[model samples]
Target: MIGQISEASPEAPYLAANLYLDPAVISALLIEMSDMREPPLDTGFRISKADPELLDVWRRLIGLLDRPDEVPVMAHHFEHELMFRLLQGPQGALLRQIAGTDSRLSNVRRAMRWIREHFAEHLSIEVMATIAGMSVSVFHRHFKAVTSLAPLQYQKHVRLTEARRRLVSEHDAAATVGFSVGYESASQFSREYKRLFGASPRRDADMVQTIVDPGP
Candidate 1:
């Protein structure tokens, strides 16, 4: 059974509606939501009022979800189309900037790509700016505009994500994973990781394992 919506507030009429969302569909939606340019609204819904195009997309998405067998592939296509439509909206200026040549957005995206590819290595904004063919100030502005985070923050996120992956797959010591992800000191890594993820690495890894393989 689908979950209930709490209230009949004017803010969200659809809140009471029964919407059957597949796990894969929910995951794809979450991923796309995270990468969207717009800041989140009050409620979980995408926009204040649903656009016809977006509703159509959602309908198709729900249709795909109804067929459990085809969900994986259909979810991918739905997410792609949803993202494409979102990028066509006003907030998608960041995407357009990145696509256009000689734009600061393009340079920031280049720097971001480089950082993502080499996240395990030590990184400096100066070096990244050079790679992007821009000055430090210009790179910082555009990068923040596109991602709502500074370069260092972005690097830290990449490192934390990689560390979490390594912790789960390799079952290495938290410190070891930290060092592998470019931290020189394990203590510093632990502190930062805890701050970002709200738990110590060991606890987080154990939680992940439990979620992945819940015993009957």
Candidate 2:
């Protein structure tokens, strides 16, 4: 996103709205929204304005934040209304497939969940492809298309993120953190951790600890 912006261009304001929906609720809402059994596929990010009605619904939702007492009473109504507005919008067809059991998007989402759950263990791309119900070549293409990273690369990123998060809570033992995060070689872990974090694990941990737990 930063790379897409011009370095010399003036900064512009943007509103980022994040919708958090429960998986069960999402499945129920999405499946019911579709007229057929299978939900349609949707691509990744695109820029667009919100529907005028959705924009109004969104404003109503945001308005609740200021009325703390009304939130418990009215949050669900606003939320469902917002969802209703989105379902009638331009991306409605794409959003409907989110609940499909056998769509490519569903398959890739399952594969991603598997990776997050078993990030500490060694995994095979072939096995991952099987989990997604796609052949190796096909899975590779779709996985890259969806995540912009190959399966192994995705695993590497997940492992590193876990390692970094755990390091903040654990003592400053880089090798121990490395082994805990599934790295076979301590030296290789340090090298890769350094490559990703721009500093050795021990150094990065100490720097973070210093900032987060600064002395009086």
Candidate 3:
């Protein structure tokens, strides 16, 4: 779900710690905890400032890295505590939906996976609706509500995102990359690419390349 992640600073280098939550682990904990479920959230993602208890759990979890031998035994426990603390936070509702198999957020995520996989193909709203197991109108409404983008609009975002990656990493021609991403007209691709990225494809790639490999 994370397309890109980075940290930048003018003085000291940026430093942070992160964790990956296992849905199985979360679901197991949910079984023991009663009345933890909440109404479905329009969006699955949530952000909250970590409180002291959550920070303490994070610290203990990070400490495991230093004691590699203990990690095999204790890491899972710490991860569970971490998720438990999170489930008690403001983000709890969103996390609960993530663990629900039939939640609307899950259905939307299913469709999102499909879009990411078939982004270069012609987008079919009907197919996306079916994938989400909703009628066309219902799917469109829910998709937009959850993701803030219509189906075709989401496809455009996926296409442009991928085009950026291919341009930067593969150094392919803009037109070729555009065609490969289902854009029929090179000019249309360039125009939209600029609209989204604030620069033409080649220019943005060059800019990124400059940042990546600055010469002496």
lDDT of 3 by residue, 93-181 (tens): 87788788787877888999999999999879999999999899988988998888999999998999899889989999999999999
Which residue ranges in model 1 land beyond 4 Å of their true spot? Answer: 1-50, 58-88
Q: What are the runs in model 3 whose C-alpha is more than 4 Å off?
A: 1-13, 16-18
Can you rank all candidates by lDDT, best first?
3, 2, 1
Tell me the tens digit of each residue's lDDT in model 2 across 55-139. 8888888887789899988988887777666666765654555545666877887999999899889999999999999999988
lDDT, candidate 1, 1-216, per-residue tens? 113344454775652224333334433444555454433222112234557887787788778656989887787787667656655564344333433455665566678889989998888989988988978997777677667788889999989988988898889999989999999999999999999889999899888777666589
Higher lDDT: candidate 1 or 3? 3
- Candidate 3: the clashing residue pairs are none
Provide the clashing-pair count of each candidate structure.
0, 0, 0
TM-score of each: 0.63, 0.73, 0.89
Model 1 local distance difference test score: 0.71
Query: Stretches of candidate 2 above 4 Å error?
Result: 1-18, 22-59, 62-73, 88-94, 210-216
